[model samples]
Target: MSQSKITPKSYKVLAVDDNEDITELLEYTLSKEGYQVKTTWDGSTAIQLAQSFLPDLILLDISMPIMDGIEAGRLLRQIPALDYTFLIYLTARVEEYAEVAAFDIGADDYLIKPIKPRALVSRLKALLRDKNELAYSSTEFRIGDLKIDSLSYTINYQNKVLQLPKKEFELLYFLVQHQDTVYTREQLLSHVWGAGMHITPRTIDVHIRKIRERTGFDYIKTVKGIGYKFTTEPENT
Candidate 1:
């Protein structure tokens, strides 16, 4: 643990995989690093544990017998208590679309298989550090009948309350805060997901599509051959 960053012991981690050997290894590795870790060999059990444990981070595997990682991740995001929890996929899937699907399901980060204990810890540390900084940013956006509150991590639209997945919310927040400004996919990737993220531009498209699906197309406008922008008024059809 780094003195300059929050202590690992302060964070709880849930590691889910169908392989008992993998889970045991994860438990041993993460526990040795001072993090409070809980492990389960299946997604169903993992979901149950998460409800009770409410871990700050989850390292999930994409392949499982009964319920896969994608389904588990989706259900986890639906848990209001776990909305802010960081999810990193640990899988052997190398297809580009697989990564895109992970992002679409609100994953915070994605790491391919063959987990490296030290590197995994470092990634967790970085995500945890970012979480700390985000806590201090008091951001709320009000435009017309819509309101976005970073504090509550909720969106108020037309007297209705909505909660989007973490990535979708952040993407929408960024576009709204910089309303009417056209940004290419690359630029949005840099500003929203950070420059170091390995996600492709297609991931941005998936996020944007999800955002539009939840909130409707009235807020986000596509620039046809360009990218996306946020607008308060409806665009001409």
Candidate 2:
């Protein structure tokens, strides 16, 4: 079965690569697909452009002169205006550690080089679709002293506002909404990250840890030999 092609032209993309040819290819291919594309050959310029362009997605190369995608991604995450912007590392690095590091630094997706244009477009469509669906699903949630506002993508804990990365916030929201229901890693992966995605289950743990650290809340209960649950009655409360 073939799925219908979604509108790609409505989105803006920022492509950053040290190789001019790669950037050119990205610009040409994405432009042909109707996307508003901008290209940069250096990470520093990519960062600067991102502030004004405010792209919906960023295609970054891990190895670049003057600055690298990892550093650039870290800095981008700190920008409140770009908090919801999708970030993808499009590089040639194949090491597992590199992939893990990219996600740790807040990349929404990671792709290797030599990819087919059709496949790249498909990936982008899927990512954007998932993002939009998540955005429209729910608007706000309140659990105990924690409050989540999906529109702003911000959380309030004990009246203190704390901003979370996109994935972390989604994970926390999902668990809190279904409080006390035990969810296995696989279930969490499906519900929070979208079904059939290549993301690892351990990624859930990383987000969970970050949520705990940021909120200083003990509401998420780890079920041994199973998974985790968000409890209404937090331990030691």
Evaluate all candidate structures by whole-model CA lDDT and list the values in order: 0.84, 0.83
- Model 1's number of clashes is 0
Q: How would you encode candidate 2's per-residue C-alpha lDDT over 1-237 as one tens digit per residue?
A: 843434677789999998888888889888998999999987889889999999999999999999988988989888878987999889999777777788788877778888568878888887788777666655788877888887677889899999877777778888988998999988998887667666666767766777788889899998888989999888742
Which candidate ranks first by lDDT, i.e. highest?
1
Separate clash counts for every candidate: 0, 0
lDDT, candidate 2, at 62 = 93
User: Tens digits of per-residue lDDT for model 1 on 130-192?
Assistant: 667555566788999999987677899988898887778878888999999999999998887
In candidate 1 the C-alpha lDDT for residue 183 amounts to 94
TM-scores of the models, in the given order? 0.86, 0.85
- Estimate candidate 1's alpha-carbon lDDT, on a 0 to 1 scale: 0.84
* lDDT for position 157 in model 1: 90
